[model samples]
Target: MSNNVLFDVPGPRARRTSRIASIVTSVVIVGGLFYLYLALEAPRVTANGTETPGMFDPTRWDVITDGRMWNAILVRGLLLGTLKMAAVAAVFALLIGVIFSFARTARSKWIRIPAAVLLDFFRGMPVLLLMLFILLIIGPGAYWAGVAGLAIYNGAVIGEALRSGIQSLPKGQRESGLAIGLTPVQTRLIVEFPQAFRQMLPIIIAQLVVLLKDTSLAYIIAYPELLNIGLRQLPTTYGNRYFFTFFFIVLIVYLTVNLLLSWVARIVARRTASGRKTRRTGPTAGKDEKVGVDTAAMNAVMPDSS
Candidate 1:
């Protein structure tokens, strides 16, 4: 039996009951879907003289493969506009996050207090308000306002994540570095930060997920991001009828990007874990070199006797 950290595995009766429940749930879901299909179709299931299409109309689905439509919408709005903003915002956010996190953790209260206040204020504030504030400050129609808004807000969140990661490390780590004659700043930058970063990498990636999704808020300031593109195209190109099909494409793109990022995070986490394991095992490998050095010293000392 495999041991799970969270919960115990079900026994025979419990497993059987679970299986039965799942089967029942599946039947109910299928029945409900079939009922919905009938309901949607019944309205226009007839050869009514109306020109309007029904919910399950095959003609509506044809829009999914409209290459010309999707090409224009996706290329500019999704790839160029949305992705570009997310990339710029993410980079700036990560940089600001790291800088402020360092400041928040600094020995000096002057630096730490301001950093803390800044992080707390931005993090607690609504992203919409932040976007509006930046837009007002920088004037409207400027793309940088949107990017700056996202960066500042997400940066505060990311900084908190970093600060928590640093704080979660054992006190012994800091003490050990100090005992080795390193100053507090050096100890933090050298010994503590690297390990904390490794430990907090998953959290950092999760925060990036939030940041990516938050890019949609840029649309409030008329920034032509993914959601804004969808909004503009919805009324102009297809109207409200094809709304689902249009946004479905956007959903797929978001899912693809975030899934790719998650995959990268997993790969990095594995590499870091393996690296730590190798470091832990390195001393044993060095023992063999120590033996070779002792043998060479013994041979040199006994050379005259030979």
Candidate 2:
């Protein structure tokens, strides 16, 4: 026998609404971009002004195919430098996140207060301003400047994520571990920290995305990232190709990176879920199992031997 219930299946109202919203947003964005393109192209030049090779030359992408302005000066300086800076910043941010996470969870103020203030100070500053300030002191290399800015800002955000996730764990979880004779360090290492990390991972991924985008700001300090390449090319060749160039850069840097990271994250989530299910069902490896004899004893001892 089986027990079940039936109800009317809802029509695809929600799906239809989502489709409508997607269509409307796409229409608006494409229309607005087309309008902006026509508007910009209308009067970009000073009439008979000497076009830089790639600026407003209209020479059929001569600048892009050639890469003259960018290759002339800032090829590796910006393209490769931006990548290195972003990588360094991510490393520093992760390191600072872990350090600050421990600080927030540690037992004493000597750990938390100063760390909190430093974290707060970094997070409070605007990323652009931070980059500018660091660039002045570090003097225009995209590597250190972008890294210093991202480390301070992204690290602060990540630290907060870790701290909040740790705090969000049930208080009883920590106390129970301690009651079993685990020291604060041992309890956090064995139990609370793992749960906290799993919860905070999505947030950390989000911050990494932000940091990667912020790397675009490297051009402001004259570090010559992808945007810098576009900017340098625009003066002479594709001055009016602003929309296309900028959006191309966005698609390349932001969209591609986020999509790839999201895919990897999904895989990780599926693996984690499988591991958790396995742990829940499988008995502890070292536990003693009382099987056939134990079952027979219970049956034999039933009331009235029945």
Candidate 3:
């Protein structure tokens, strides 16, 4: 009945319904996970006289009488390769982002538009197709094709991400730096980028989430990332265990990485906010000012005061 629309509240029955829905959702999610676990260990039947169970067995982990396929495929093959590729990608993307972000935000028309066009050309291109093209041109190898592909596309996107963050900073910050007689580049490097980077931490993390998932595409070019490894270990009887392998390895990694990043971002944001509070409380509160007022000189100064 209140005039303010914000006063609207849910009734008791609605709260009960919400709780009921939450319980149902939780049950479904748990059940799905359990079912997938069962499917992963669902007995791999082979052709002719040989039978290889295509699943990870926890209880009999030591009894790997055959090949350590899980170790080969999932560990040394996919997991390590992914981490390596992602690390390389992050560094390259960071470099690209810095260059593009600076160029885009620069006052020079000649630099900004052209740089923008180049970034757009790369970013707009399909990630998978672009990687494949590079693979064909550059020849196949983990570092050459796999990591290179990750770097090219991710870096292009990261460049734009950085530029967006820089743009979102308060306009007054840049203007103030300029008004204080700082040069354009000085203003950006010293004032704009630091604050902007802090504020854009959240979005940068979100982009990382995208980067994490895109690693799966490496499988297409035989890059032997986690998914690629998982596929190789697929049971003949369980041909479409992609749902399990991918969900367990890929999505698990994605969620875990994103969550960890989010936690780090939250900590950084809290620290940044605390820093702002301290700055606002009084930047010069601690130091004693050196007032060089000699007593003898003060007597002479008092005579001149009249």
Whole-model lDDT per candidate: 0.73, 0.67, 0.65
| TM-score against native, each model | 0.77, 0.65, 0.65
Compared to the true structure, candidate 3 yields what TM-score? 0.65
At residue 165, give the lDDT of candidate 1.
65
Q: Please, what are the lDDT tens digits per residue for candidate 3 over residues 1-306?
A: 564576547689877998999999999999999898788767766667565554664433332333565575457655686766777777776777778889887788999999889887877677777787777877766456756666777666666656766765556778999999999889999998886666545445556556666777777777767666655544332355343543465556556765786687667657766765665467554334221122342232122111
Q: State the weakest 10-residue window (summed lDDT) of model 3.
A: 297-306
Worst 10 residues of 1 by lDDT: 297-306
Model 3 gets an lDDT of 0.65
Flag the better candidate by TM-score, 1 or 3.
Answer: 1
When 1 and 2 are scored with lDDT, the better candidate is 1
> Per-residue lDDT for 101-135 in model 1, tens only?
79999988999998888877887788778888878
Indicate which candidate wins on TM-score: 1
